[model samples]
Target: MNKKREIQSSVKDESLIEKRRAQMIRGAVTLFKQKGFHRTTTREIAKAAGFSIGTLYEYIRTKEDVLYLVCDSIYDEVHARLESLDIEKGSLEVLVTALEHYYGLIDDMQDEFVVMYQESKSLPKDALQYVLKKELEMVALFERLLTECRESGELKMTPKEIKLAAHHLFVQGQMWAFRRWALRDFTISEFIQTQTNFLLQGMAGEKISTQGAK
Candidate 1:
């Protein structure tokens, strides 16, 4: 619904664009997650989105546009989930809690995440960069939280370290979905606890555990 998001479509009416795109995105994400972007056709996406093939074409010129839309939607959902956490308190404990919440979301949206990553390469250069920028915004959320901790003197890390640490945490959450074939033996809870423990301890000199803390 955000106009700022870069989505190439022929529809010009903002409200119509939002409504139809919403419908299209809901349907497309399901099909993409289940059948993958390469296997999904525009007709199938239009049917799933409850629109005619003609209507679908009015909005998108290609199936790749649907893939771009799906990737954008996934990023928005993940960022929204992470933003829902209580991050006002920028202590190490609060950061760990946020990480746990984020990891849990990634686990729940495993199929979506997998689809987003696997299909992102199919997007046009501009669309792919848009998605990547959205990813950076999510990373910046953690970077801001880390900055808060530093400003409060509760944690100490260099600027670049903070950036890389935020990036690392995001990657760790993503690993749950992408590496599920090999990580199948571990439950989401186990994965979160183990990862949070390593990240917390590594980020701070203290022995921190978000395992059961949340």
Candidate 2:
């Protein structure tokens, strides 16, 4: 009975630690997004997280460490979402649906995504490389999806064209997050529908409509 109680106590402590870590990450993401990484300080992050500077240091070594943590978490979430998508069936429809889901996920993680996008270059060499590697993996995932679409005859672009198109498509998605203040007036479903139609019609070798219709 004593051993069982001790085990329960340990589990509770671990859960509390995870809760605190998540809170810190959430706070750090907001600060980093609002004030860019260079402008934000560890002390600010600590205060925002409702913890002392010393306690913040106990969990994260520096402001950069917090950036890395936030980015890693964001990327992990994206990778998980991508992994669950069924890219093998109805490749074009799957890609459209996956992209819509991707946009929603990134929108939900807007703070972290924005911070990482804007401030990853400020990291030290090794840390910047680590972040870029994760970003490249994401890029490759999209490229693969584009390639599958082209091979499946769902898209008419050549390999080189597909790669370029994928890059542009990604940039368009990023614009939705980066320009959310201006885009906030537009709903996510509207943005997804508009963007998806734009990409699909263009990739299908059709001319883009000026009035935003396919």
Candidate 3:
């Protein structure tokens, strides 16, 4: 498990800290989507979160801390959604369903996804590394599923190929949010169907339509 980076807080109650931070993340992510991280002020974040500036400062010292918290919350949600998939079964059908769920997640959180993708780089060095590590944890979920498929003879990929394929799968999901202008013509289901077919064809050498999976 990745150790969460300790954010300095004046509050003593752990549950209160979590509760306030969730409010902070919800508020900050919206402002981040509206105004890029550098342009948004800590005062604005506090107001958006329905609290005073002093209350926000009690939870975080710097605006960057809020960004880190937002990024952390986003990854936690993404991991929870992906973790529920039947990756252990390792069939091509299972893999395709996983991709569908992942793409759907990205679609559902497009604003949040765009904010994290664009503003995460503004975090401090340590916070940025923590966020990147969280990203790899997500990729590893896909890697494990792909490895299981290979072990079960459902996918004919070498270990190296599996690693690259997993990274590709992770990035392709991000493309929907990162390049929405280019992909505006494709609906979420269409995007899922098209990408799943492409990925499965390369990994399993069999084309599978995910239209029904949509």
Best by lDDT: 3
Clashes of each: 0, 0, 0
- Full-model lDDT for every candidate: 0.81, 0.72, 0.87
Off by over 4 Å in 1: 1-3, 6-23, 26-36, 48-51, 85-88, 211-214
Sort by TM-score, top down from the best: 3, 2, 1
**What is the per-residue lDDT of model 2 for residues 134-168, given as tens digits with 9 covering 90 to 100?**
76677767788888877887777777887787677
Per-residue lDDT of model 1, residues 89-154, tens digit only: 677777877887788888877877888887899988877878888888888889988888887887
Better of 1 and 3 by lDDT: 3
Query: Which model is ahead, 2 or 3, in terms of TM-score?
Result: 3
Better of 1 and 2 by lDDT: 1
**How far in Å is the alpha carbon of 174 misplaced in model 2?**
1.3
TM-score (C-alpha, index-matched) for candidate 3: 0.91
Error of 3 at 137 (Å): 1.4
In model 3, which runs have C-alpha deviations exceeding 4 angstroms? none
> Model 1, residue 19: displacement in angstroms?
6.6
Worst 10 residues of 3 by lDDT: 205-214
